[model samples]
Target chain A: MDRSAIIEQLTEIMIDVFDLDDLEYRDDLSAADVEEWDSLSNIRFMVAVEKAFGFRLSNSEIESLDNVGEMVDLIQQKLA
Target chain B: MTDVLTLPWLLPAPADFRARVRALKSAETVKAADVTTLAAYGLDLSQLGSLGKIVDARREELRAEGRLRPVLLGVAATHTVDLVAEALPATALRHGLLVDTVQTDYGQLAQAVLDPSSSLAAAKPDFVLLALDAASLGLARPQFEAAAAHEAVQSALDYVASLRDGVRTNIGAGVVLHTLATPAESLFGSYDARVPGSVRWLIARFNQRLTEEVVGDSDLLLDVAALAETVGLARWHDPLRWHDAKIPCALDAVPLYADHVARLLASARGLARKCLVLDLDNTLWGGIIGDDGVDGIKLGQGSAKGEAHLAVQSLALDLRRRGVILAVCSKNEEAAALIPFREHDEMVLKEDHISVFVANWTDKATNLKAIAQALNIGTDALVFLDDNPAERERVRQELPEVAVPEVGDEPSDYVRLLSLAGYFEAVAFNDEDRKRADMYQANAQRASALQKVGNLDEYLASLDMECTIAPFDDLGRARIAQLINKSNQFNLTTRRYTEADVAAIQSDPNKFTMQVRLVDRFGDNGMISVVIFDRGLDSWHCDTWLMSCRVLGRRVEEAVLDHVAAAAKAAGATRLTGEYIPTPKNVLVEKHFEKLGFVQTCERDGGGTTWALELADYAAPALPMDIRTTIAFAA
Candidate 1:
């Protein structure tokens, strides 16, 4: 529910959806940094996150998120 | 056969599912068998997508290794079909098909069908799916005037008919059309049905008209509106996702949608399950029939629990009425199992309804195999429904091909779970389908009588069978097509044909077609055999020879061969040629031509053999049945 916890959970989701060995969480890490993080997998990642956090990201919210930091910040805001 | 892998009935959470996927990925070499086993479990949308990627990769590898040939499915949709396409292969695995999909560009369905150079045309798929939704087809637009709404419906249907004709004439591929799922939100709420211009009313009318058009045709229809109604329409249509990504339905419901499509495709391939093998005790009735006597069993209309058990019986009876064969497999004493079916007043399934009943102290896996053998169907065609998880797990472990739904403890949930599994999905229904269960029951009766007679000759003679052999006509065309697709065992060539194909054959001047029906003192076995022969100057080639296995060991083949040889000889043919094509299910007829006195003439690659019988020296075999024919043939 906290920022660090949200970051950790988001990292796990990305690792699974992207089929990565491990991910180094950074403020600017985005789809451009991963080959497998395409549009389809991005949708999968959003679905997984919503199922995990028990909150839905609006269509616009899902489209506008820029990076890992932005997604973590959005989760923090939704939780608040 | 390899060992059956145990899997969970319920789908796991995302984390656990990912863990399992990771383990599969870490294997030294991913096997298609392992992937198929994993796919047998219930999967959600995310898991379906993930597993579909694995299936696609494995499909390529298998194709490259010369071990797999997939059915090419061409998809054309007005919305984004990427997710549905991705989930299709995984869902298709459950129905015994390796599907490789080629999708047309978004909103290019018309162009793809019209243009010869499009990728969809180039793919030359076995089946083309026109996945149109209400919004994409303009059916979602409401018109205040009834004339405008009717015109809109007419135009939409006309456009679809054009596409269907184009697909058939240009690509020569089967077309799969879908009904539009009407929008959930209505403008006038409960009064929407009163307004012919309302979106709901217009779409419903369109769906009814669509069903009327496609019902007797050779093409397949996926009832998307009915599917949406099954799961709440509100859950089926995701407006947010549709507006954002053009997703046709909710992402979570994609697996279910793909499953329905897969089942329809499987039915066309003659792979739909035919029998429902149910357990006694907790499955059919509430209390253990053995421990609780016939009077103590909770069934019928007394208590809620009693009615719940009765509902299960009612469902089984209904399935039987629609031509699905029913069998009972239990571990209790045979007498105890029969008491409820015979003595209980509230029982919906009676002793006469079941074709094969096995009650012994054997393990369920072995008993299920026996049931399949007794019914003359493959183990894969059996759907085992039991209330005990342990028994379900054992059957899953032993006979992985048999469908075992993770039916929870509640008897009330059994019908819903089994219904949603779509194990008995059918594409066509005829009078023959309604009487199929009765025919199987008659076969069971003949089996019991054979045991009493003690001699094959005496048994055959005592039954006093009579058959009417005639040329294929319009009246028997539907049943002929159904038998051609449904008969896997005792089928010489295992060739599948649609009703349209059969109709074309019927009118061909150079071909001879026969539809054989047998009836004895027991019951009428309605059109049990279909044969087609190609006429030649000196030889008549048997293009297809298939008989229902329920009539096996009764010298039906011998009688048919006698009639065919006489008919061919009478028609100025000097010889008869037959071919045996081997398939996993058709081994029952591997030596068919040889047994019928045809000498092996040539051996083909891939275990196929050709045989020829000299009609100049053909001797009619002694047949038990009194055969009558519309065609003139020397007896």
Candidate 2:
């Protein structure tokens, strides 16, 4: 999937899983940007992102992720 | 992506009747009919097969047909003559209204005339029928010697009477009671050797004690079951199939059942059957289609067995014609079952008559689950009919949630079983029941098409989607509550709410409630979603937000945000905020807002993620999916 498409797909999943109606995910969007983005949500988000992008995230890696932009980059690298 | 509705057809039952039952099963109202003859099958055995579900299906059918007539439930006539006078102006219960059946035998015309209350003048019954079996006549147990026994019978009688003549005049909406005598056989079993006089004596004694308790007019009527024995004709297990006998003809010599049902016709409310999930084998016709070829299938016009099935099919067709939904769940090979509907000349039920056909060799319980899923209905709303006790037991064991019936064998007395259960009895008919089958069938087509699209955006774009988000109102209140109870996935803060709860929220101005409806290229996802926001000073909070999983992958979430942001901005709110409360099933969308553009505001102790989006700077992403959005001004 294209990067923007992956970002878009991530956006859809976030709105659906977290149920946030008002959310914006640019490449720079960080953990501080979303209301429902927490540890558990982070785990869920990571799992979902891994599935959607055809990759996996370790506990340490998931715990280290702090923003949407970083996660997007990680997913992009995995895709590359 | 096969539309199950369009799949090959099966069964010998009429298509229309099945359709009507299917339509009513999902109705909001609960319609109840009388089931007099059902007592013969023995409640335990009757409850084992389609009997229970059929009865319940009947109630749903009644509701769907909008035949929710006021009902009058009549109890033992011999025990409570005062039941009628006490039962008048009855109160409506979950089942319907109750009425006292007339106490006096029709032959005692002088007694009916003499007793002021017994006189039809004081006690007008839309229809009066006997409820108890006359078999008790011979067993004439003496008056309750114990207070507890006395209270038991009295309470049962009192409950029956109270239901009939409660202060609530609208108790039995369209139902009525009538006066008639119990036939000798009804009091005595078909095999009973008791003489007629002895039987009458036993019944008279039984009635005398009950009548002495009350001083008012006995507004009750006698039914044919009090006169002659329904014997094998109406009884559930008369092994010697009386080939040439019709219920009218069989009752000609003993008109109690006919007369009572006819009199009750005044209160005859149209009962529609909802969701008739039928089994193929011995229940629908004489033999299994798999074992018995199309030529051998006993449906259409000829033999008694064939005729019996035909009679049931005709009844189902009439119900469907009046608005019932039909479905099939059988254990036979799909190909063999389809042969009857596709090729058999005498088959009454066609492919279109059925809303869903689950023809796999899976257990009936699993099949029923699939059926419920396909119809988007609760398992409690279905009535499964089968001829095998073993299959019924499996369903009862594994899928205890689905209602199975007691009437497994004995297809000959299918009509009588319905009359006895009164589960499908109704007072009137409605448009919803009639159109429901078609609606569900249409839904099947939509579901199949939806499955063909890949990914959420592709699905959304293909839908040619249009969404309307509005606050809770009278029109969508019930739908919103139903979604709260039904929707599993794509539900945020899965707060279950009932109609009353929704009403409470709608009445509270402080709580802002809204719902979303999506209509795509295929059809309307009737109220596919809902959202509730509690507005705070600087920021708005999400009270509840949920959507149907069917519409999940689409950028509809973006549309919801776009709409919410606009509303928040219009309301002068600085920020729009929401939280993600993770439940095991909803992990699929936990990161929803990070993708949307909302910034994290706070995290709760229990792993809750709260995010906020500034109203001034909120911008929607370039959604790859095509989606049309509309906002209904909050009222």
Candidate 3:
């Protein structure tokens, strides 16, 4: 997946998952930006992303995917 | 049977909200069988006058009852907004409320919300329903950016944030703002896109923005979207193409929408807090082991009913995954209870997932309390689910705080009933939740070690009782407060405090306080006890001393006694003394000090016993205890 496309997909997922009305994806945007991105939902988000991208995430991979930039990077690696 | 307290809808509420609330009142039936019928209409403003009249009637009826206090009171304001404002003073005087509407002045609204007279302050409706007009946010084909309207929205948002903090501080007050941002669909033109006009579109936009702004702040948002969906689905599902006139009244849809609103409210409260205290018998699976034999008991994937039971177990396991602690409170022969837990392959929640397992024939409430004490949570957090209603009712009456969901007579709806309760919703997950069961299991192992200790002092010392006492740190504060709330027998002075309270104590230099985490070869007993003190002008007074009952009789008490004695001696105090206030329970420890060699200092008339131990003569017993120490010096 193109990094931008992956970012777009992740943004859409975040919006849907958090029920954000009009979410604008920024590199600094993280789980902290959204209230509904609770610990349980975070795990669910990871599960959903894994299914969507067709790749399993390790503990390190999940931990490292904290910020939007890191998420985009991981997505690029998976797609590559 | 009419819930005269509920605000009558603008459209005549279909006869159903009354019927549904009535059913809830009566034990005759469960939640409405077909709530789909209730979900069929939009908020019809034409009936606003009628709704006002009905509300007046209901308020009068409640006033007549004298005892009926409305959890939430609803009022409709017509074009006469000033009259509505004027009525608030008298309304607050009589019914105790100021209206919760979209404010013309955010400051005034905040003051009103903070004031004791505000409806938000008095009634504390979990959410304030605000009726807004469409023009406020510019409803169009493309949604306008909320940031553009930030100036006006910011004031409301800030006021809301202020109210949020205020509500937390005050009792019977936690006001959440819910905006109904729309006029009427028919008046707004084809703005509805599918339904009718801008009203519907405005409602959707407002709901969307309001939801965003509220974020984690609001308990729940009552949106008109679900009701619109219900109406749309109803219109489409109708076989005969009917005109608007032939369609059901929007009022008829009120009950359905109301129920959806109620469920949403319940969900927002965030899952019925329920530590699942399960009974092991035919309850978890099938068969009475003493009678049917272990192998004969129905279980496994092959048996359909067994599968259903296993499905229930699996649901419980899933609930545990979501942070619900699964505990076993069964009245069975201990060996029989263990058969399935230890031997059965299909058991989803293994022995370890059970945070507290009491297989003895003890009264379940006692066992349940033991579990709550062990877990260091309130009994109210427990939801006792058993196939037997008798068992359920027993616990319900004894531990009334525990939410006992009524499991139906039929086997099939067991899973369905459990799901409806939603007893396992968690805001966050933690390592503590996952390891809770293992901790309890380890405590059980620690219990077995207690049996081997030769004498009280020897046992306390032999297991190498290590006390990790430090000034109450952030990590241990929650567990400490939890100990205060849950600890009973070993608790000298049950001084219940919250996390904030503990932090306040830590900042105060006059008070000497520390929590002790007892650990041994068996396992880690996390924050097992706490003690506090005040060095009085004449003497050093031991304020509070509490240890976990699980770690009691293991010379944990010896550590506490020794610590307090040494502290008193070090302070150059003449004597050390403590007080014990009697409750229905804690009678077990009424004679605790007499056993510990404390002399009676003063005995008040019909109050509780008080004791004092002289620092000069107090000899710290040289017990055969394998002990480690971590005590802090007085500041």
Candidate 4:
């Protein structure tokens, strides 16, 4: 799947995770952007991302990724 | 396809039963209707969290209706419980909220369980849930010496014991301990599982110690690791989740965790199921037994379906060994139905493993009721398993009290489905449990013999029954504690005591504890009765007097009282006081004092009639047969 397609799926998962219908997702968005997004919830969020995009990220790799854009970049590298 | 929301499959059980099933399958948000239905089974943690908002609303609604019973739960976790907090509340709400827990902070479990003046002590919880992991307990790492590992295990156990004593002394809420989930991705690899000082070996050793500890201590133990194994270790413990949230278990396993804890609480509340009623044909074997003769039945290792049937049989046998009565209810000719068990070479289940087997062309609902009648257990205590959907559905519709988990088309998933039902969640396993099937089988044999003998008293004498009454010993403690918790129908005063409570009562100079073991020509009944009497100056008060329902009408109760009166007289007590406590289940014991010829004494304020018997004037209850007695250990 292309980056845009992956992002669309990721956005849907993000919406489901936060339990908000109108919750929007952007590449530049980070944990600060979402209200319920915290360290505790990041595991669930990253798990959803891995499922949506089909790639695994280490704990350190997840900690390193600062924003959704960076996650998309990482996904691109892994998928490629 | 029709809308799943229509819930056409819900039938008579609940209007939204399908919704709960759907919730487990796909996260469509947990509805209020889903709450009661979901409580019946487990869900993955992710599925549970999906319904958080609905659970929150449901909680408030429950509180408004005054249904939520407040339980102060002292929680100490190795992880951040943001997800557990979200998941467990809904699970609790669904299971009728025996404990509407007000939990303490994370990382404060030691303080909650140990210190009297801890914030948790101030909360004054009804129970304490200590989710201690091996890492936090300092036993996860590979030790240099096996002795060092042994020391750590001993220290952890001692620490827990001290905490329990502290809680009893200070907070008064009993502790509930969890067996550590063997950390996925072992440090020592294969060596961990084999080497004595390795992490896996030490962890296993620690679990053994915990088992021993729970048998001695009063606190309940939850085997999260065993539950984790059933859920699959990879699925149960997610490393990423652990690393990020400090959550030891996988987020998806929250429902299972909650479910197991809920069942334990239910067992503590005396709601555990007693019997498993199985079906033949596809349930017990791979195909129809009538169509496929004994020689042709698919029950051997050649086929996957056959192996699955064998697995179910293995599990059923295991349950029977754990005091869960096994019975068969099948809609086929008796000969054809039993042919697999009797003659089939590959069948793991034999006719002897089952306490009750009814095989005929009768409808299963009727057969199940008959089975319960023969076994002297309530229909509610029975769990019916059948491979046929129609049979399962019919049982569910007719006997709404009976648990009917659908055995799907896939044979591989058979045992998994049954295990998830949690019908036989064990609080304690003792020698009695292992020999329960044999005892019941002997009861059946006695019932059959009772028909042949003309004289009732003569028949009793023919059995050559001998009972040995002795003071409670350490070897009999677990079974004694179990009987106190489980023996309900014949129980007077219905006093439920844990192992620790039983120990205290046994050791107290002011109280007397004695247990009776019966051995007839058939077999040993194995510690069938317990009596705890409170010794007074001139009068002895009977606090707990109970006999197993299996031994009813065998004149054991009469023998017990006669022995107790003799003992009381020898101890220079003139009067023996007994109370008749009325419960919904114990009506058989209501007129017990009257039958035993005890004089009418002052009735206790606790809704029970108190009666007294003068020891010197009391005559030994006459028996047609010669009585044998051994009272070696005095209380």
Candidate 5:
């Protein structure tokens, strides 16, 4: 449940939700960068992330996240 | 069939659905059968969305290759229906349907139905689904007065009626209506039932009124309120999701919703299963009946385990009451299997309830096929229930078409799982459905009588069969249409007709239609056969010749042919032509024309053959049944 561990698990979920081959973890990585990541898929991605991290995300928390770094930070804060 | 025991049952849906999807995607060509097998292990919204992508691609490939023609389903909903549409194709695959859905834009259900030039009308779907919610129809709002509430319900129903009539006149599609699910939020808590204008009261009234209005029609009703109540209203409705995405139900419940819709559609298309094949030991009752004596077996009112088994028997009996054929395919000795049915006082399913009973040491897969054969139904029309996982797995491997639900070790779970499977989903029920069990039981009596008599002709003579034949009239139209759709094994040219089509044929002067009913000493077999003959230049062409498989070996077809030939001769036809069209289930009638002295004139490429019988050379076969006819024929 450390930052890198969360990032690693988060990358696996993104890969599954977006059906991507590979993804590099970075703060700049966002929905616009992935072609398959749309509004509908974002809902699925959020659900998968919540399930994987064992935490629920509020509607505002889900909407406010802008990048992989923000999502990782939210997960870390929620876990804390 | 014996080797099925060596093969493993289908693996349960993997814990990691994404991994399974990846594995399926990695294959060179993902087969429809593999996708269907995966779909059979129900999925959640995310899993359904993932699997639906594969189903869509596979459907396109099959349609492009001329291997599939999907049923077009136009979905119009008050909320966003993308998720339901996404889940449909994969869920439909479980019911042997490739559904191509055209979804109307969010909150445009009324516009889609009213506008003649809309995409829903242009696509001309086989079924138009009106997926409405209580909130969308304004039934969720509490009216201050009871009269206002009544007016609200009436207006909502009137609006729905307009939409249904629009779909029928504009698109010519069958309408699928949804019952409004009462919102979880209640104004007065338990006291909501007392208020006429309460959300719960209004929604319940609307649902009841909708159900009453569509009872005797072809409109398919998806009881979403009942479904929501089953899953708990709190779990079924999500306020956050509704506010954000405009989704009708919770995302997790979309798969079940899609499955119910698919079952209704499948039932409408005559794909609902007909029989429930059951195993005895640890299934109907507790403990092995053979090992434990009748008095020793744990089955009656004493213990919790015994009552659980009794519940299973009660469910089977209820299904039989609804015309679903009950059959027994067990591995125990015949006498041991019969002991519980005959001597046990606690048994709910008696010997008379089961249509076909096969108890032997043979493997279940082989015995299941025999049961299907005895019932004259396709193996696909059977749902096998057994407590043993190994036997269930073996049957699943041997007969992939037979539905084998994964009932865990709990006997109580069997009823829930089978009920949720929707295997015996039905759209219509008539008098024939009520008497179906009795008809099949009488068939079993005739079979046992044949064995005792030791001669077929002597058995037929002892039965004292009487045939009442008449032209197709209004009274027998419904049964005639049902027989046309259901009879496959003993059907020549396997042509299906609707009741409307049968009515049209009844009035056509150039066409001759016969509805045949047979009765013997055992019991009355109601309207067992239908024959339609079309007059050609010098011959009477048999457009449809089908008989109930129960009356097959009794030479009912021969007697019907005798009457047909005599009628054709009186109608100034020189020859009678019949065709044998081969379908996967209709192989039993391949040589029907040839055996009836009709010369094979041509054999089509797909194993279909055309035969002709010259009227001058045709001789009526000696029939045991006393023929009674209302139509005139050659003396």
Candidate 6:
């Protein structure tokens, strides 16, 4: 899958985790943008993402990523 | 009566089920599915992504979906118990529970149990679970031959018993007790495992003590130690997690723990499956007995295939000892199927162990119906296990209540797969459990005897039966409450009572509670009857009356009323009044009061008969059987 496709799937997972409605997914959208995406949900969201994508992200990779765009970039680099 | 085959659809087709389980891509999909639907799909522990995260939200979803069967649980842990509390919601969903958990202050099980203002008292949970660990119980690092080690175990048990007694007296909830888990970090190195004095062996005995203590009591023992064994002890606990948060169980192990707890609670509620229906052919042995002769089948001593089948057989035998009836439902020639069980030297399950054996080419759904009829149990109580996926699917579509375990292709995986499903969840173990296999065997004997007799009266007379009627004792109270809570057919008022309620009835000045046990020429049907009657100034009012369906139509009802009339007379009553409240299942007892010659004076407001019998003309009815009766602790 292309990077944009991976980004789209990841965005859908975040929507499910936070139960987001009337929300648009942007490349720069981060945990701070969503009210329900607290630290616990952040871990839960990432775990769901990893499960959906069939990969594991280390703690450093999860912490270092700033936004949805960076997380999508990490996924693309892994697929490469 | 609705036929088992015509039951409404419960599970989807297997391929569709697998597809649905696979399609659970996100938390939204999972939360949307009902608890039973999730369990039917059989998602693995890891397949469910971070169950801890979704546990709370799923509670509301479960309620919204109307899939929530609530089990208000009281949890008093000796250590950190957040993981168990967290895992409970999702894991309990597998067994169909909302799992309303009430937590006590850490290490304050006694205070929580005693204090009326405590959450345990206020929540009034249906069940109480004591989450114990070795370190908290003071047996983590005992000396090899230390006397203090044994004393400490005894003291811990007394402490737990007091808590159970307090709950029984105050709240009337069933207590679920368990022993400390044997840590993976053994103090004595490898060789000392077999030594009786070693910590490992001591821990094993401690677990046995825990189980034995709750054998006849209203309490149940959760086999967390067995759970720890199934999932290796090393994997069950995390040292860092324990150090940081005092969590005894690992995050990953929480789901499995919750599953075990849910099973115990379900069993307590009398929802456990009773019979195990087995398929022959590749299921019982390595090869088909029809093609391969008795000697040709691999089930005995040496090979891995043989050992796997043997393992399954051994588990079946263990299940039988614990009161799970075994029956055969297979698509093979009856004689050929008998060859493996009767003629084969390696067979662990003999013909005597099985309650009903139906071996024919007919579809298993039909055979299962015959087995249920022969055993006189509901189709819901049956657990059909077969290796053929097509046969399994057919049965699932036909009878959804029958628990069809996902026994994979290999014989090696059969035992592990069935054990994980937790179909045969048992509440209490007594002499009755050990004698259950024999009772069913006696049913077969009774059937043959009935066929030979000329009429129903003649058949009942030929049995040479004895009924022992007595007041409630400590030993029989659990079984009494068990029958009161679960017995549907032949129940008079269908009044559900806890063990504490039964205990209260015994202690009350005006109330008289009694239990009846029967033994025929064949075997003892343990505690087949229970009655609670209230003594008024000039009248006796029946509060709760129920008899086990196992002893129905054997003149036990006549004997029960005869005994009650005498007791009512002795207690200075002029008249006896009984009520028959109808439920969907208790239609078998619709004419119960009328049968005893008690006139139905009127019907109650909520649809039940108010029956009255004048004690002036009361006389014991002459039946064809011999009876010995004692009324201990008479009113």
Best by DockQ: 1
Error of 1 at B67 (Å): 11
Q: Model 5 - which docking category? A: acceptable
TM-score of chain A of each: 0.95, 0.80, 0.89, 0.86, 0.96, 0.91
lDDT of each: 0.83, 0.53, 0.55, 0.72, 0.82, 0.75
Q: Which tens-of-lDDT digit does each residue in B220-315 have in candidate 3? A: 354555444534544322211112112222322433333333334333332235478887776788777667766788887887878878887888
The superposed Cα distance between candidate 2 and the true structure at residue B89, in angstroms, equals: 26
Which is superior by DockQ, 3 or 5? 5
User: Sorted on TM-score, highest at the top, how do the candidates line up?
Assistant: 1, 5, 6, 4, 3, 2
What fraction of native interface contacts does model 4 preserve? Answer: 0.31
Decide which is better by DockQ, 2 or 5.
5
Better of 2 and 5 by TM-score: 5
In model 2, what is the error at residue B394, expressed in angstroms? Answer: 1.8
lDDT of 1 by residue, B61-89 (tens): 64543222257889988888888888888
Per-residue lDDT for B425-456 in model 2, tens only? 43333443455566567667766776786455
Candidate 6's TM-score: 0.82
Interface RMSD of each: 2.4, 25.8, 20.4, 4.5, 2.2, 7.2
Ranking by lDDT: 1, 5, 6, 4, 3, 2
Q: Which candidate do you rate higher for DockQ, 3 or 4? A: 4
Residue B595 displacement in candidate 2 (angstroms): 7.4
Which regions of candidate 1 deviate over 4 angstroms?
Answer: A19-25, B1-32, B60-70, B115-117, B632-635
Candidate 4 per-residue lDDT over residues B1-635, each given as its tens digit: 11111111222234443344445445444333445445444343444565545555455554444333333455656666556666665556443453445555766666666677788788776666667677777887878687897888888777766766777777766667778777666766777677776777777888888877543445778887787776667677787666656778765566557767766765654557888999888888878888978877778687887888889899888888787889999888888887777777888888988889899888889999999889877786788888789998788668766777655677667677677657676666667778888888998999989999967888898889888787777778878877887676888988877566777887888887778888899998898899999988899999999988887788888888887787778788899998987775788898888788888787778577989988867888676434456544276
Clashing pairs in 4: B45-B252, B72-B125
- Model 5 residue B521 lDDT? 94
User: Which runs of model 2 end up more than 4 angstroms from their true locations?
Assistant: A1-80, B1-276, B302-304, B314-325, B373-382, B415-436, B450-456, B481-509, B548-557, B578-618, B621-632
